[model samples]
Target: MTDSIVRVAGLTKKFGAFTAIDDVSFTVERNKIYGLLGRNGAGKTTLMQLLTGQQFATSGTLEVFGASPVENARVLQSLCFIKESQKYPDSFRPDHVLASAPWFFAHWDAAFAARLVDDFRLPLNRPIKKLSRGQLSAVGVIVELASRAPLTFFDEPYLGLDAVARQIFYDRLLEDYAEHPRTIILSTHLIDEVSNLLEHVLVIDEGRILIDQDAEQLRGSASTVVGKKTDVDAFVAGRDIISRTGIGGLASVTVAGLSAAERAAARATGLELSPVSLQQLIVQRTTSDTAESETVTTTDAWSARS
Candidate 1:
């Protein structure tokens, strides 16, 4: 609802005979950190490419900064895209990249970049190609944070980073973002790690937008109930079940949208209530979708044979 920095409508992208990004539509509001989440080969990268003008969409409209992003200088100027596999010139060093960053990013901060370099312990004089994978990822993280672009996309930016280094990236990101508010889209497999940093979440499954909701709302949207199999099943009879598993007479069920009374009733009935994390919820949802799709395909094949 707030002023959106990116507006997409019926967007689709394909490669020869394969569709990468299916018809997806969503809005990315300004000054918020969004988690672009999904499994591998789920079109998260393709969607980002389309938004950043790295690849043309096969169909539908995508607007960045209220205009077409493809070759639009005005829109491109305010964007910075950092990725795990980012390449640099063979002759370039950390210092050289830092020196040239200002030319590309109007809001580049040299002082901040220097601080980040120290934080990540990057060697300024060493050739980029010689740096270790963690060090290389650090360089990209430094540029992304220092760029201060109005719209930034980080696609798997911490591939080779250690836990400590990844924490540093998160800390620096939060600190810098507080001082300089900007819209950031983070794409990564480390869902639980950055779950706290996200304000909104956009989950894509099989090239389609699956979940678009506020992080806080999603946090409390579902609860896991564990009890006797029959009792648990009865309690969740009409509820939107995200997932359900049973062992002998005991059953554990994850249901969506339980009211205060419902929770109290479950507790009174000796059913244990537990919170469901965002990562768990998404996994369950996507897995359920996949299973359903497979089932439908099998059914169609069987009907044809019959």
Candidate 2:
């Protein structure tokens, strides 16, 4: 097998006259956690749909598990896609979903699924229609984690989960992945919370990929510098400033790509520079109108900013 389990070359998805994912391409390696990050309507969901074979791509080549996945039972059987607003039948109950999961997944772990239900305090007999938003989200996480699909896509898996419950979910995920490694693509906006768990990150902006890099590499790409407003502005004048703020004589400016020389210079100048966080970098790099702007970045500067 190739190093990548899923590969998309020039992938595009259009909804009528407008495109939801454009010219996007990437390779997902096995046994690594990938963060599919972007603002709302930035095509994150659309891209996941394409990768899971839930929707057809309008153009370009797509391969999952080294073969075309369109209506292929062998390939579809190995994929698990738990969506944020996942819909169940009107009369469906949480127990019903659990009961039927094993029929579709070859590696379904009933014991693990039951443990997750108890861990999340989910009511198996509760009607899905009557479940709270948070409870509904919990069920999706349970199913995705227990399914043990070779390639899993979690689209906003922890929507209404509280901080404690979310942490528990993360803990369980890492523990299980450690034992049975596979490809997991998690799409979420809670960047900092899950940043440490991701091995790789893909930042989508307005239907296009803005950044594709190792999570560790991103930690050094940008930094925030604080100092006198004049000094801050002067130091930032010739560089690419991702964001800037000031109050009276003091200023804080976030800049992209601070090399060793620049870091040393900042230290000498008494400018306190802190590494920019993954969340802050993501929010700053994505366009404000990303939901419907169709304004994908045409350059590499956005990746640097992110």
What are the TM-scores, per candidate, against the unseen true structure?
A: 0.91, 0.91
- Give the runs in model 1 whose Cα sits over 4 Å from its true position: 288-306
- What local distance difference test score does each model get? 0.89, 0.88
lDDT of 2 by residue, 1-306 (tens): 339989999999999999999999999998899999997889999998888788999999999988878888889999999889899999999999999999998889999999988888999898999998889999999999999899998989889887777988999999999999988999998787889999999999889999999998887889999999888887888898887778999999999999999899988888999988787788778856443233223223334533
Model 1: which residue pairs collide? none
Count clashing pairs, candidate 1: 0
Q: Which runs of model 2 end up more than 4 angstroms from their true locations? A: 289-306
Which ten contiguous residues of candidate 1 have the minimum total lDDT? 297-306
Give the C-alpha lDDT of model 2: 0.88
- The ten-residue window of minimal lDDT in model 2 covers 291-300
Error of 2 at 86 (Å): 1.5
Give Cα distance to truth, residue 115, candidate 2, Å.
1.6
